[model samples]
Target chain A: MKEIVVISGKGGTGKTSVMGSFSYLGKSDLVIADCDVDAADLHMLLGPDYQRSEDYYSGELAILDQDKCINCGACLSVCQFDGIQSENGTFRIEAMNCEGCGYCQRVCPTNAIQMETQKVGEWYTSSSKVGSTMVHAKLGVGAENSGRLVAQVKNEARRHAKKEGKEIILIDGSPGIGCAVNSALSGADYVVFVTEPSVSGIHDLKRVTELVKGFSIRSGCIINKCDLNSQMLDELITFMADAGIEHIASIPYDETFTAAMLEGKTLVEYDKGPASQVLIKSWEKIKQFAETEGCLK
Target chain B: MKIAIASGKGGTGKTTLATSLSSHLSETQDVVLVDLDVEEPNSRLFIRGDQTHSQSICKQVPEWTGDCSLCGQCQEICNFNAVIKVGTQIMLFPELCHSCRACSELCPESALPLKPRKIGMLNQIQAGNLIFVESRLEIGEQQAVPLISQTKDYIDNHFDESYIIIYDSPPGTSCPVIEASKDADFVILVTEPTPFGLYDLKLAVEVMRKMKKDFGVVVNRDGLGNNDVLDYCDMETIPVLARISNDRRIAELYAAGELIFSTIPEFKEQLLLLERSLELSTVVDPV
Candidate 1:
């Protein structure tokens, strides 16, 4: 299956909106993966009915065995994270504050502090109204293993695509070029960069583009809300050309995008406006490029 | 006073406001600016100063020695699979290692040794009366939280009694942001008047509430959208510290690498008001 991952260097750049519109256009043949585990909002727009969920455990957190006799301060001194605390002559572990480093478990003289695998988050496989399998997750609050959760979500999407004989796997990647984004782009066939037309937008675009190129993944750019700054749009186009990146489409500023979001609909479903038309055309071009590159086997 | 300027969303004027406020405050009083956004630090662009000191921040990862007896205990104990043993040869991926030291401490054969790997750099610079300390993670490197923790250590060790330290934190309420905001006297949440902004601001507030840190909001691009942010803050009883209008000049100045308070004299007065307001509030222990 051909996989296209849409990512924005910065947040709130219409990455999800563009992905939602693309989902509407390619409703039948695609599997949607929301790799933005830090704040997964694709479910809100796609309105997926979650079917199956599995707990994702990657790191070990300190668990105190209160049955142990002596209350020693040995674990507290070695814990650099300040995860261990003493109160009322008893020792306790704050899971949220723990980095799961196991230093406390190591330093505990009595072996009372045992390392236990804790569920940091959960990944879900769901069915969206668009007839596409939606794979997403919710990172536990104060959780540290987002990269692992992202990988799980992508793997589930890949498995679903192979099982259902889906033609495409479209991923809504996380913002920023962190571990989560790296996991999303590891095996992707194509990457679409959705960026805004602002100074910081251009700045982050360059950063994330460098990251995307580091993986040797072919990428195209789509400047969302390009009318917000015409000068910036021209600069972005020039930059894309200089960087040997193709400009897929320019989506202008539209209130209908927000209106659609408020109504729990994609832009294509809410309004058949120019923005929706541009997104549809962009989706077609992406499909053509993927097929030309033999990504859609 | 130690104040942390943070935003729930990236590019929401955290660095911009922190640098502007630092430059303004430095004119009259001693101010130290700490850029704790180790993942993507850009504060050095705004504050050009000669480096006074630099240090390396490292985290401990397990290094397998040739003395391994192929017991497989390290592999079994590793929850992250950072340690893998195949055919009596043990391998470790440092990037995947959380540095929990579980493998090293649990290995009975003493095959795994805790090795410190430099993941980032901490730099201290002096710009007039203000001191700028910035933590920058190495390219393609993980572990921003450790660098932030070390930066906080540097701040504690080198903080001057007469200087006001303003911390410019990373976006999001993750480990790195929590590390930056820890032990701060006050936190200033910078946001814009948009749906996404509101969504993220609430998340940041939730984090602050969990941390029990006192905070207020500063709405950037105030007049661009309707007063939904103001209304939300009012309804929630969260104070709106300042509302900066949609100022093109300020934006241009920021893009041009010019300090806003220096270019726009009026912002200096506004920043002074913010300083005074923060000073009047009682300080609380961040812990």
Candidate 2:
């Protein structure tokens, strides 16, 4: 199966909106994976009828036994995160502050602290109105290990694809060149970058492009709000040409896209306006490229 | 007072507000506009300053020693999966490593030692009353919180208490945002009135509540989005700090890299009102 991830290094460049349109307009049977686990928004557009849910444990949590009291403060001294708190008489560990480093566990003389695998997030498999399977996740608010959650969602999507005989997977990835974005990049046959025409947008696109290059992944760039600043658009085009990256689409700044999002639907489903029409053409271009690419594993 | 400009959703004018606020506030107050969004720092482009100083930030990753025996103990102890036994050679993913030193500290055979790796750089630019401190993370680095932590720590250690820091945070409710806002005295969340903005704003509010951080909201591009953000803030009793009118001039000025207050004269009155609100709010948690 072929996997195409839609990502923008800068947030609110409309990655999810573009991904939603792609999912709606695509002809092949596929799955939608919302790898933007930090703030998964594609599910809001897809309205997936959740079929299965599973707990995800990316790291360990240290639990201390109160009965085995050794007030020696050995655990406190070795902890680098300053997670331990002294309340009245007993020492307690703040779960949020702890990175599960195991220093406190190793330093505990009386074996009071033991590490337990922590469930930091949850993933779901569901059926969406677009006639495709959807794999998504929710990382606990203020949670760590979002990278792991993203990986699990992708794996599950791949597994479900194999089971159901799907041909492609459309993933809505998160922002930043961080752990989560790296997880989204792994094992993807194609990556579609949706970027804006602002300075920060172009700068981030360059950074994320380098990251995609390091992974040796075939990629494409789609410029959203191309009319915002034509000079930036020209610079972006030159940069893409210099980097030898394919420029797939240039979407005009249209209110129809936002109106569609407000109504909780993809642009294609809401209205066939200029933005939606351009996206449809973009999908056709992506389909032609994805079919001819030799890098698909 | 450290005022953080953050929004759960991106492109909500965090950098725009931060840069303009810095330039305006510097007219009368001491301000250090620190761009804490390490992944993509952009305030440097909008503002002018002298390249005063820069320092490279480093993190230690585990390196296999020559006399290494693959006991797998380091792999067993590490929670972040930084260490793994790959045949006779233990492979390390430096980007995934948190540099907590647990794997090296717990290595019984002393074969796995800590090695320094450059992750990012901290930079300072002096623009008169406004000193811009920006952190730029290396392109391939996955972990941004450590660099963010160090950058904020540098601010805390070097800057005087009287300077008001306008910290611009990365978008989302994950570790980076948490790490950036940890030391903030007051947080000003900027949001539009769209559904996407409202949903993410609620999440940011929930996170701020959990962290026990005093925060208010600023509605940007007011007429473009619906009244949902304002309605949500009203229902939750969260104070609405400022509302920037939906004007093409704002977008045009932003595109041209012009300060919002300088180009649009009306923005100053609203900015002053915001300054007043911040002053009133900071009294309870005074410096």
Candidate 3:
């Protein structure tokens, strides 16, 4: 199966909006996964009916037993992560700050600290309204190991795609060039970047594209709000050309985007506006590119 | 007072609000703006200034010195899978290491030792009284929290509490956002007025409440989407700090990396009101 991940280095560039339209267009042939576990919103548009969910545990947390604890502060001293909190004569472990490195447990003089596996999030397999298997996850608040959860979601999506004989695995990736984005891009066949014609957009695109180039993935760019700044648009076009990235589509700024989002619909499904038409044309190009480029070995 | 401007959703005007607010405050008072979104820091795009300083930031990870006794203790103790023993060779993956020092300390033969690996760069710029500090993660680096934490430490070492510090935090309700906002005196949650906006806003609110942080909301693109976000904030009794109207002119200025409060009179007025509200909030909950 071919995997195509849509990501924007900067947030609010319409990554999900584009993914929603693509999911609708790809239908049963696609196994969709939303790897933006931090603030996943693709499900809001796809209307997935969750079929199964599994608690995902990746890291460990140090739990201090106050009964066995001595006030020596050894665990506090060894912890690189400020996980140990000391007040008066008492010591506590802050779960949020704990890196699950188990250093505190090894350093505890009284053996007061114990390492426990932490359930950082949950992943779900669902059938979306667009008739495709959807795999997504919700990372716990203030939780670490989001990259692992993204990897889990992608693996689940791949398993489903292979079992169901799906041709494509279309993924909606997160907004930053961090661990989660790295996990989502692993083993992907094609990468589609959804960006805007803005200073921040171009700046972030440059950074993320640099990261992607390290993987040598075949990629394309979709410029949303292309009409907002003519000068910025030219800059973006020039950058794409210089970077050897194909400019797949240039969508004008249209209110139909928010309008469709408000109604819980994708831009293409909502109305045939100018932006929708451009995206429809671009979808064809993405399919052709994905097929011609061949799958990653 | 230290204020963090954050949003759960990307492109929700966090940088716009942060840069504009810092620029406005710098007209009279010294302001410190730190962009904690190390993975994709964009505040530098809008808040240009003279380069004052730059430095490469590194995180500590364990490195094998090839003196292993083949005890296999380091691999067993490592929780991040950053270290592994392969056929008489020990491999270390610096990108995956959390630098917790467990593997290094637990190694029986002292084969693993903590070493610094460059993960990002920190730059300081000066625009009049506004000090803009931005950290950008190096390409192929998987983590952002270490850079963010180091940047905060740099800010604490350089800037005193007399200046108003603003953090342009990364989007999401995850560890990076938590690390950025955890030490702030107050947090300003920026959001647009859409279903996705409202959904992510609630997640952000839950995170702030869990952190027990005092926060308010500023709705950007006010008229672009429905009133669900405003209504949710109202129901939650969270203060609506400001409302930046959905204007094409504002979008154009933002697209061109221009500050709205500096050019738009109405936006300037809104920002002044926001400043007043911030003053009232800070006074009531003084640090």
Query: Which fraction of the native contacts appears in each prediction?
Result: 0.15, 0.59, 0.91
> Which residue ranges in model 1 land beyond 4 Å of their true spot?
A51-58, A66-69, A86-91, A129-131, A196-199, A225-243, A251-277, A294-297, B50-55, B223-228, B247-257, B262-273, B280-287
2 versus 3: better lDDT goes to: 3
Ranked candidates (lDDT, high to low): 3, 2, 1
Error of 1 at B160 (Å): 3.4
Query: Which regions in candidate 3 have their CA more than 4 angstroms from the true location?
Result: A294-297, B280-287
Best by lDDT: 3
How do the residues B1-287 of candidate 1 rate in per-residue lDDT, one tens digit apiece? 78999887666788789998887778777789998877667677778779999989888998889786798988877766789998869989887777767788778988899999988889999998888999877656656777788788888888866678899997776667778897788899998876666777887888888888899998886666456778889998987887776677776666545678766766665665676667632334367
| Alpha carbon deviation, residue B255, candidate 3 (Å) | 1.3
Q: What DockQ do the predictions score, one after another? A: 0.29, 0.66, 0.85
Better of 2 and 3 by TM-score: 3
Instruction: List ranges where model 2 is wrong by over 4 Å.
Output: A86-90, A294-297, B280-287
Q: Chain A TM-score per candidate?
A: 0.93, 0.95, 0.97
The candidate that wins on TM-score is 3
lDDT of 2 by residue, A1-297 (tens): 888889998887889889999988863488889999987888778889889998887677778898895777888777766678777768988877787888888879899998888777789999988888899988877888888789889999999899989988888899888889999999888889999887888888988888888888788889988888888889999998888778998988777777888899999999978888889899988877777666412
The predictions' CA RMSDs to the true structure, in order, are 4.3, 2.8, 2.4
User: In what order do the candidates fall by TM-score, top score first?
Assistant: 3, 2, 1
TM-score of chain A of 1: 0.93
DockQ class, candidate 1? acceptable
State TM-scores per candidate. Answer: 0.87, 0.95, 0.97
Candidate 1, clashing residue pairs?
A101-B100
